[model samples]
Target chain A: MSNRYEARFSAVGGQGVLLAGDILGLAAQKFEGRYSLQSPTYTAQVRGGPTKIDVIIDDEPVMYPKTTAINFFLSLAQGSYDAFLYDLRDDAIVVIDPVLVTKWDEKYKTYQVPVIEITKTKVGKMIMSSVLSLGIMIELTQVVSKEAIEKALLQKAPKGTEELNLKALRTGYEEAQKLLAQET
Target chain B: MSSASSEKSDIVFWQGNEVVARAAIAAGCRFYGGYPITPSSEIAAVMAELLPEVGGTFIQMEDEIAAMGTVIGASLVGKKSLTATSGPGFSLKLEHLGYACIAEVPCVIVNVMRGGPSTGLPTAPAQADVMQAKWGTHGDHPTIALAPAFHREIYLDTIKAFNISEKYRVPVIILIDEVLGHMSEGMIIPDPSEYEIIDRVKPSVPPEEYNPYDTQYGDVPPMANYFEGYRFHVTGLNHGANGFPTTVPDICHNDEVRMIQKVMKDVDTLTEYDEYMLEDAEVAVFAFGSTARGAKMAVEKARQEGLKVGLFRAITLWPFPEKVIHELGQRVKAFVVPEMNLGQMILEVERSVHKEMPIVGVNKVGGVPVPPYEILEKIKEVLQHA
Candidate 1:
């Protein structure tokens, strides 16, 4: 593992991007025993506007909370993808939900997935797309342990919908594993 | 009061504002009066939910002024009270802030600062309120304001703000910027027994003999709460020892001097600062609030490149630690002051060092913190010129 790993989750407001960042930070800090800092930025609009959160994890304390160079980037919408694409490192790993982000630069390695569709079909709710994307993020980067992410999801997920969210997470993880195997 | 577990400490992930609410509750703060404002509204939200659970009172006042009024009134009745707001709301509370100062009410006012001269950038960060927190209320009265750099200090300094307010019988301000107010990190909530909670000194004498502002008891007279069987007057006017308004020159002068001395006399004990790698450094970075986070990283990176760079972080911004700055100024060849504003605290740094040493201001005003490289570049520029 690198000494430091930085990730940015970009989506429109009300897409649960902020909660995904929160769960990722809690997973690293609480269960994985790593130091992490999460800083979020959003507009005044409550929904349908661009929002982004930066999460920096490291073995040592994170001195600079904001991400200067991104190692992992997750884009849930085309607008957020275009807005934040310049911040990614040259060799950065980028994940896009193909339904929303149809166009992208070919310089960086990118994984295209139908995140919202999988959540709707497998989890029975479109709002759980952020959780599904989180599962894909863990499978692609292994930034945090799956068990740690699962524990954080259990702790943070709403009381009545834990089972459905867990199913969404598993479906996304399995789909990503299959895609990676085919590429190799 | 909720007790901390005696067996072992529990570590939890908390945002900076949440820590303030939790620490306030743990410090026995039972009354919270606040109006909603961004970057600080969460403190009021959490307090509203948590205070009622603990049998404490949480009030959503009509405006920031009313919030300040409610906090002062609650404190006068012997309840530990606080209010939280951002830049614009803090601007509105200055009238009552002065009232709390002259009336000598013990309360806490938290300012989670955002960019502005007005309702500027509600979502962005700035440290421009450094001077306003000191002289925002219009008078020459002494002020105690603390700035915390991270979440842990947010928790600890909030409790300290309450303690100092109770100890000196004055309003204590916890000055935090937008970044620290909204960021999330992990911290261990220490055992409650480990905290030092200070309550206001209650009157010991009979009702007729009690003088609320008596200097004979060494500047801080024991206070008597309303309806507590002691009838003592309170007002914003220059009051005598008996607590009633007094226009007599001698009485007013003494009252003003005593209020200032009560805090200025204890400057040594009240001041708090952290010095990093200053023992053999040629240049030092002076910063406070969220700016120090980037400054520390700059200092570490500069040291790795064989430049003798260190950091002097001020946790207690008011009662500005002039003594420490004065002593360090004598040894360091140059000082770099970095802040989110164009240059607020740099003026204080320049004044303290007496211009004997080179002072450079690395400032940013676009509602973002000064990057570490910018500070490092300034550090190197100063060293190269020296």
Candidate 2:
């Protein structure tokens, strides 16, 4: 309910990470029921390199679209985890793609998710891991409704890939449900 | 839209550049002259199309210099006219624009900024024009500028630009930028009962009693137009009140000093900004245009995580809003500036903050918004040190 929260997403190009961050920002607006302003800042590497996206959500008026110290860190690449080890909050909850980040430091206890392999093996190669990882992000926050996140995903994904992304999203969501049950 | 209206209306959603054109139309503007540039080209295009619709004439001048001259000439005949351009065009226009200021002609100038120094980035947004908008014109003359931070602010501020120009009988700049101009979103247009339109204060006394540059009341004088049944001399070479060319040394000094004093005395009313969270905070972000939107987000996210961050968005970027900035700088340990340019606004932030305090900048150039995490990193750094 506070007016500020900084969420950072890190990954490489083609990871659909930008799309995931954008959807969460949009969902935050819909969650507020006004024209919620979503200001995102990202890096400019065209090919393969560490790319980070920041999404800020608040109930009050937004003055600028940038922030620091991500409360939520979603790392879809090994580079993302390595990059964000120092960038996150002291107790920041990190969701990592276990396939990419095979190793983890003891200083930070992270949620290791086989996001890429599960997405590629079950959802097929044409789909991206970001869609699946978004399911975990939404499930974890519970701040935005699944429907709201889905609409944001539908609006953002490329022209022909929306359906597969949605399917991959559902598969990921079901996977998270199993994890939630196991933890409980 | 059948009949013409010289009426100012309430706030509404409109493109930043287009709002300048509408302001010109609402102020009884009868002439428009401009050379096109990105960000600001929309203003000229809108004027070219709509000016004729309102029974006014629109001219695309040869260059910024000619564009400025044409508007000045048009205004001399009692016409409210305007011109719109970007960084380079504005650079070409300042000399004549300065002439308009010294001559006390009523005209609106809109500069929709792109990145700069030279050509720079045509599509990128930058507020590098703030200081220039005030002092780019040569010599000491009163210049009024209004910067709109959103599409909605654009409409209201552009109308304010016209009113300020007409009320004082001088040139005013509708300083807008590329982000507000090109960004698109929709809103319901307002009905007519919302605005108070103003026109120049015309002289009601006899022609013989008039002094064009008289400082009797010391604000700005209302004299007859060149041929409005009264004769008045207009010159760029520093003239006398009797409508004749004057080279007298004291007269020149008085004329220059009077022009600047008029605006300087009323700078308080001209300055504008909107405060958020600064009423209770230890760190704040100062931003404008596209970068401001990003800063707003970062602040919100930081607060959710229990970090103390505030936002200060400048709706009117010119005149520098230094007082508000200085106040916040005194309370907050540091003021973070996030801008699209490499470091244009950071210089202003640094200038105002003035202490060994941490003044950070999250810059994004190459045509993209500054990412939220870049801001997050700075916030965390600030938090850790604190």
Q: Which candidate's TM-score is highest?
A: 1
Instruction: List candidate 2 segments past 4 Å from native.
Output: A1-184, B1-14, B190-192, B345-356
Q: List ranges where model 1 is wrong by over 4 Å.
A: B1-9
First chain of model 1: TM-score?
0.96
The numbered model that scores best in DockQ is 1
Label model 1 with its docking quality class.
Answer: acceptable
Ten-residue stretch with the least lDDT total in model 1 chain A = A59-68
Candidate 1 residue-wise lDDT, B177-264, digit = tens: 8888888886668676767999988878899888998767788888888998888889899888888988999988878888889999
The residue-level lDDT of candidate 2 at A151 comes to 70
lDDT of each: 0.88, 0.71
Model 2, global lDDT: 0.71
For every candidate, C-alpha RMSD to the true structure in Å? 3.3, 9.4
